[model samples]
Target: MHLGQLAQITIYPVKSSAGLNLTQTQIEPRGLRFDRRWMIVAAATGHFLSARETPQLLQLLVQPSEQGLHLQAPGLDLQVATPAPDGQRQVSVWDDELSARLADSETNNRLSDWLGQAVQLVYMAPENQRAIDPRYATAAAQSVSFADGYPILLLSAASLSELNRRLLEKGRGALSMARFRPNLVVDTALAAHAEDAWKRIQIGAAEFAVVKPCVRCVLTTIDPDTLQREPDNEPLKTLIEYRRSPKGVTFGMNLIPLNQAELALGMSVVRLA
Candidate 1:
């Protein structure tokens, strides 16, 4: 709707876990480095597992390491090495079937025991390519990591403010921005849902195409800190009352990088198209 500014940048080194903030970072085609590069999947079925079903994943905190990534949770901590593409594992994310680098049996066992379910932490190999949905992606060949469908999820601060206002009016407590889990958070002043109309935008030196309105899911209903659901599922249920579309009830916008780019916090966001 008007001029906006990038207020924060967050990276989820592991899928569906807590994200770590950064001052600045390179923007790869897939996403920021280590962003959703790793995910926890079912050992038997090899399907992607996330906070949607196992809220325990939300308790893990991510940190980038020289060897690979570091993960810390309530009673466990893991330092995962970057796996070679040699260990092949067929895994599925949504409709995209891609080969992922499987972790060692020990790592799998530890994670499985901690979650109380059989699961393995896998990495996206260089050869692994999960192509973005061509219908929304700016380029047909663009690929992503373990993120739902796009490279980035951008949310506006004004949007959360509006949602909080609605919750307050309804006699419900407010929720935090972490509930939505975005890669980038922009301050749109007072324009709620302004990002919905953005086609393309420049954040500092980085150019991103706003591909699609991100659909809200069951995962959004979980509390990031407690890893528990709100008794009312207030925000999501409230969002559905007005934000539903033919596609789904949506919240933020998904973005795809236009070229090699770098983004930092406090950058001014300029609409390009």
Candidate 2:
């Protein structure tokens, strides 16, 4: 049955950097094409950097280019070519350690200057198979990109509207969906937090398994436009009052694609199981 319509598609080509909104995209095994395929890592420790600790990352604008990426910040505008496979480096994304290809030294230097730290841009080459956490994997050998956990994150507009309604009642301003960084947003008549019960769904020509409810973090309290922490942490503080679970306060649902296909805005969403 029709449950909703796809409202938005967003892809973060580089983890932690700004996301690029799209009207349509192809879904691959890992995720939407170019989604979180590139990441910034500490040069010394080889650990991933995210807006949770480095709010400055939210200010970096990244656009996917034919050759690689076009990155821009207040004083920096640079074109980074797709890294060749030869420069191998071990990078850690949370608990997952994998081999990734490092971008050229010039690109690394420019980014480091922009962030005022020693950092390198790394790419997950096709051969670097980072497995999805087995505890949550529905299919054997499922792989994912550099995303925080799952391949795709889905949220309903109705859910955000409900959150905003509560925020307004509390004398707080509304927030945009960008704060949550979801790959998909569905406009539906479902009640607030209804997606938490979804087990399987189909959008456009692709099917997906709703794997888990997304656990929100301090990253949600940062303003994407100003790159500053909210003085009151309104949304998160409010969410914790009502949305807390054993895992943490939750906001969205994580998804794993079941097949290769294309997804577009306005596509009907069907609950399968």
Best by TM-score: 2
The window of 10 residues in a row where model 1 has the poorest summed lDDT is 62-71
lDDT of 2 by residue, 1-273 (tens): 789999999999989888889999999999999899999999999999999999888878888864799998888899999888889999999999999999999999999998999999999879998999999999799999999989999999998999999999998889999999999999999898889999999998899999999999989999999988898986899999889999999999999999999999999999998
Reference-based TM-score of each model? 0.96, 0.98
Candidate 1 accuracy as TM-score: 0.96
Error of 1 at 109 (Å): 1.3
Write down the lDDT that model 1 would get.
0.87
Best by lDDT: 2
Q: How far is 270's C-alpha from truth in model 1 (Å)?
A: 0.2
Model 1 clashes, total count? 0
Q: List the residue pairs that clash in candidate 2.
A: none
